[model samples]
Target: MKNQAYRMALLYDFYGDMLTDRQKEFYDLYYNEDLSLAEIAENYGITRQGVRDVIVRAEAVLTELEDKTGIIRRFHKMQEQFAQIADALDGICQLNEDRYQDDALEGLCAQIRSVLSDLKQE
Candidate 1:
């Protein structure tokens, strides 16, 4: 259940702008704010089922966008690849410290780490 919610949140992060305003609000309330359907319904003066419908439609939109574009999927893949690169750089840095003590190599690793950090921030 938690993982499902997390995926929905990530989907929203990727494609939320495509949703209608009401759908966006209801989805955010249910997923990000952790609001129950009943609570959101009460605040919005609607039925719980109505709130659920809006959130469901928002989810459908997000999922459809992902299916069409695969942007979120690619983003996750890039993040995993970046992590692998980071780990490799860490190993190289350790080897340098223990054996080589090469200043130029260390500087190169630092540069790569900086670029990796910037990519991950996106």
Candidate 2:
């Protein structure tokens, strides 16, 4: 349940602007705010079932969008790749630190860092 909630939050973060205002509100209250369905219904002056229905519909829309676009999946893959690149760079820096005291190693590390910083900004 906790994992599902986290995934829902991530999905919302990625595609929430696509949701209707009411849908976004309900989703935020129910998932992000950790509100009960009854609490959301009371806040919105609706029945618990109505709140549930809206959340279910919102989840469906989010899932459909993810299935079609796969932006979130790609983003995760990119993050993993970046981590791997960073790790490789760290290993190279460590291994070459003793062998090379020149600016070449420092220049290579600086370039990698610059590239990583640019990618993260995107």
Model 2 misplacement above 4 A: none
lDDT of each: 0.91, 0.91
lDDT of candidate model 2 versus the reference: 0.91
Question: Residues 7-86, candidate 2, lDDT per residue (tens digit)?
Answer: 89889999999999999999999887889999999987999999999999999999999999999999999999999999
Best by TM-score: 2
Cα-based RMSD of the predictions, in order?
1.5, 1.2
* Clash count for each candidate, listed in order shown: 0, 0
Residue 73 of model 1 has an lDDT of 87
What is the C-alpha lDDT profile of model 1 across 1-122, one tens digit per residue?
98998899899888899999889888888888899999999998999999998888888889999999999889889988998999999999999999999999999999999998998886
Task: Compute the lDDT of residue 69 as modeled in candidate 1.
Answer: 97
48: Cα error in model 1, Å: 2.2
lDDT of 1 at 50: 94
